[model samples]
Target: MNGRFVRLGETGRARVAIVIDGQAVDALEGDTLITAMLCSVRHVRQSEFGEEKRAGYCLMGACQDCWVWTDEGERLRACTTVVEPGMRILTTQPEAQWATLAL
Candidate 1:
């Protein structure tokens, strides 16, 4: 066995690819958009103040870094959302509606 390498288990595996910014991005099969996205590069999570690139932590649903949009014109949390074949996702501003937060 190579001392510099170790095999990955099923749990270590990730998604293959996803569409973002009008492009198909590579990722693990099970990775969230946040994980799958920034894996290739930073900036998946845009800084609140500027355009500096950022990445996500706690791949779980704790952090809100995985927010995105679906081809259906619906907003969703990337960490909580699973990949569906040909399903479009948008990782930008969520549709703001007054009725949703009036309570």
Candidate 2:
């Protein structure tokens, strides 16, 4: 799928591998998680309150709009967290995994 954000410049950075949901995505070496996510996906994450998707309100770490989780249930501030090679990100809350299992 096409992403919401397009890269107009800085195309020379090394690519890093990361998994979003279950799909493999390429991110820049020094990019923040939010930047990496928006580069390959339409939205940053699904809203916990409803079905609406979110793409982050604040680019900095001051807001809670960019919260995402790891496979291990660790919360991350996508806008402030740097993307790392082999990073596995879940746009949905990790607790949802348990909810699914319980169903």
Candidate 3:
């Protein structure tokens, strides 16, 4: 799939394999999560408020727009977090198994 961000330079770095929302993506070594994500996908994550998708507000860690989660429900700041090999990242929050159960 085509990504939002186009990699112009620095294409010779080592590649790191990561899974995003069940799809395999290749990220460069020493790249931040946001850089890795935006390079492989259109939007970083869907907005919690609505259907709108968010890329990132601030490239730095000062904003909360780049928040992402792991498959295990751990929250991570994409702007500051580095991409790791074999990492499984989820763009959407995993629903609780009991969420649909009646009280």
* Best-fitting candidate, scored by lDDT: 2
Task: Give the number of colliding residue pairs in candidate 2.
Answer: 0
Output the TM-score of candidate 3: 0.90
Better of 1 and 2 by lDDT: 2
| Tens digit per residue, CA lDDT, model 3, 1-103 | 6798999999999999999989999999999999999999998988877778899999899979998899888999999999999999988755532354534
Model 2 residue pairs with clashes: none
The Cα local distance difference test for each model comes to: 0.55, 0.91, 0.89
Which run of 10 residues does model 3 get worst, by summed lDDT? 94-103
lDDT leaderboard ranking: 2, 3, 1
Residue 21 in model 2: lDDT: 93
**4-97 in candidate 1: lDDT tens per residue?**
1122555455545567655676555665566555554444545445555445556688977656666566767766776654555554443432
Runs of candidate 3 exceeding 4 Å displacement: 96-103
Number of the predicted model whose TM-score against the real structure is largest: 2
Question: Candidate 2's residue-wise lDDT over 1-94, tens digit each?
Answer: 5788999999999999999998999999899999999989999889988889999998898878999999888999999999999989888887
Quote each prediction's TM-score: 0.56, 0.95, 0.90
TM-score of model 2 vs. true structure: 0.95
